[model samples]
Target: MKPEIIDHLSEKQIQELCQLFQSTWWAKGRKLPDVQRMLNHSDLIVALCHHSSRQLLGFSRILTDYVYRAILFDVVIRDNYRQQGLGKILMEAIINHPDLQEIEGLILFCQPEVIPFYQKWGFWGKSDRLEIMIRPAAETELLQEKAGSLMN
Candidate 1:
């Protein structure tokens, strides 16, 4: 069955997204309130839902300055839904989104195993001029979901 593609989600759907995040190793510890906050801070959101049950099946988001750069994040599909072209649907939707078409770059970070999958979209190692940097932070049970979160 064809899934419904949407840009916005309801409260219940937001909870569903948190659940989806849990299915992945990196996002395993995501919490509901944190997910809500993430949604509020994101520039654009893409979600695919089950046609009849309204369940979130695939999701991705973008942060862009509209003309200079855009970073794609959390591109995920439910385990059972993988290999069904939903990831392609999410990527095409992001690339073709009217608000993002003029953006000069789309960036994302993924594990090496999936590198080839994204090459079809023209993604590759960026210029040697810049690379990612990170710091170690302790985990929190509560009272801080965005300890290092910053979005505009």
Candidate 2:
């Protein structure tokens, strides 16, 4: 049986998504409200759900400008669903989505173990001129730091 791929999610799906995040290492301790807000602000989200049960099977999200660049995040499949080509399906949907067809580049970071999996989709790590840099992307962290500085 095949699963359904969907872009938009409902409140129940959001709760289910939080549970899905629990299966992941990087996303451990992810809270429901924060997941909801993350989904709200995301540019594009792709998820594959079980055909009958509607349980989420695979998921990935993208932050894109629809032209210049995009960043892919949370490309994960259910623990039991790996090696089933579902990741390829999710990647095909994201890369070939109409809105991103004209985009120049897409970027993502993953554990060294998954480098080969992502490399199949043309992701390469060797870049001399460009490197991925991340600041404390969460606003709450910035706010807390500011408050601490003011109190000191």
For model 2, the superposed segments whose C-alpha errors exceed 4 Å read 137-152
lDDT of 2 by residue, 1-152 (tens): 57898998877778888888898767767899999999999999989888888888888899999889998998888888889989888888887888788989998877778889888888887578965544454669655563444233
lDDT of 1 by residue, 1-152 (tens): 78998999888898888988888756877889889999999999998999899988889988888899999999999899999999888888887899988888888978777889899888896567975654436556321343333110
- Evaluate all candidate structures by whole-model CA lDDT and list the values in order: 0.83, 0.82
RMSD to native for every prediction? Answer: 4.6, 5.7
Residue 40 deviation, candidate 1, in Å?
Answer: 0.6
Model 1 error, position 102 (Å) = 0.5
TM-score of each predicted structure versus truth: 0.86, 0.85
> What value of lDDT does candidate 1 attain over all alpha carbons?
0.83
Error of 2 at 21 (Å): 0.9
Q: What TM-score would you give candidate 1 relative to the actual structure?
A: 0.86
